[model samples]
Target: MNCLLFTWRKGDGKLKIHEVRKQLTTPLGAPAYPWGPYNFRNREYLNILYRTDMEALRRVVPEPLAIDEPLVKFEVMYMPDAPGLGAYTEAGQVIPVSFNGEKGEYLHAMYVDNHPAIAVGREVSAYPKKLGAPRLYIDSDTLVGTLDYGSLRVATATMGYKHQPMDLALARQELSQPTFMLKIVPNTDGSQKVCQLMRTQINNPTIHGAWTAPARLQLFAHALAPMADLPVLEVISASHIITDLTLSKPDVIYDYLAEH
Candidate 1:
């Protein structure tokens, strides 16, 4: 399990890379092994990659006792609201996004894993700590939801898991992780309530290899009492995996799976 860190600075447009090393040990007095020397530049990118690995561990691990090797890559794009968070520009690199929302800036982190974690019970300890709760909406069998961060809305959708077909396995898997939890919170305006919490293990291979479990929308009112009177608009979080890019070469993936 190698982890790469990609750091983005908004001012000068620079991307720095760093490698993180972790020791995986067994009970015996001998050396268990060294998992990484992963490359990355910052913490936000690390968080995104960590979440991806956590999801893979939960949904795709067919066996419990096996050890899997996954090659991972990450990219972080930061649109800073204020200075001093290490937002500096570099020569030749262009800023990937603009600051259009009220928040004034946004941070978008993208993670790509070539060989991701595929262990059933073996947990990846690198999951994110600041993920917001998902708001879930279902129309017939389709699953749709939004993740609200103050005034910002992150939208997500899930068709279902492969084995279960129509079942929302990704949502269930996310709800099942001990580290991940969901709760209803009032929105900034007292008018409504929204879901608040973080999620883990929400990926399924059957449906585009992407899935999201949203929090309940009504809870926003109760969670943020002071803002109950404010107008609420539906917003969507744009987090999703392009399966063709992420899960290409099924034969190769299966071959790697078989080797493990």
Candidate 2:
């Protein structure tokens, strides 16, 4: 058929294949986000460290990573300006874990209000990022952070405004720890294509300011957003930090399906 021949001719484009091969991200011509390393200028964070149930912590953390303690960090972050991804608000829960005797934090659950952030986080790294409503701002005398999923508030955190200044050296040391994540990509036939533990370490970031404050956090039960699954037992410590940092691309450390 002439129509069939025309369609085949239209479909047979040689340059597009070469162009796609040379590209960095998804889509043939248009990418959702630009290539990394994404730089954040004056990134602010409201980090709330709390104690949680040890048994609950073991359920989500995968193998090879030993739970350092019965602890979880609830963080709400606001980025003023990010190149290629623009500014976005993010909030999530991370668990402190140890891999081969080295202390690190595991990427558990992250929610961002920006599409580019959600795409880049999952596509590039194994970051468990989803699209949700997260806000980080300051009220009259308290710093407030909240996460909402479909009109239901999943987590809320409040902190006193900058009570004591945190030492910059100690802050940098804490931030430089390696972050581990489970990267799982499925194959076309629904079988497992890729399952590995990925790691990334942030190093030599310029810290602008850091502070510790009395704070409180509450996690509500949500079917989709399972921040309450860990069940915050007690608020241990809280910190509000502002810094300029760079997000590093992850490297595969352990392949779950590798030969024994």
| Candidate that would win on lDDT | 2
Candidate 1 regions off by >4 Å?
1-96, 99-105, 108-142, 146-260
lDDT of 1 by residue, 8-126 (tens): 45465443332122334443344322243222232111001211233333232222212132211111222121112122111000011111211110111111111122110122232
Q: Give the lDDT of residue 156 in candidate 1.
A: 29
lDDT string, candidate 2, 1-260, tens digits: 36343333336655554455688787757899988889999999899999999999999999999997899999999999999999999999989999999899998999999998988888878989998999998899899999998789999999999889999997887678899999888988898899999999887889999999899999999999999999988999888889899988789989998985
Best model number under TM-score: 2
lDDT of 1 at 9: 58
In model 1, which range of ten residues has the least summed lDDT? 88-97
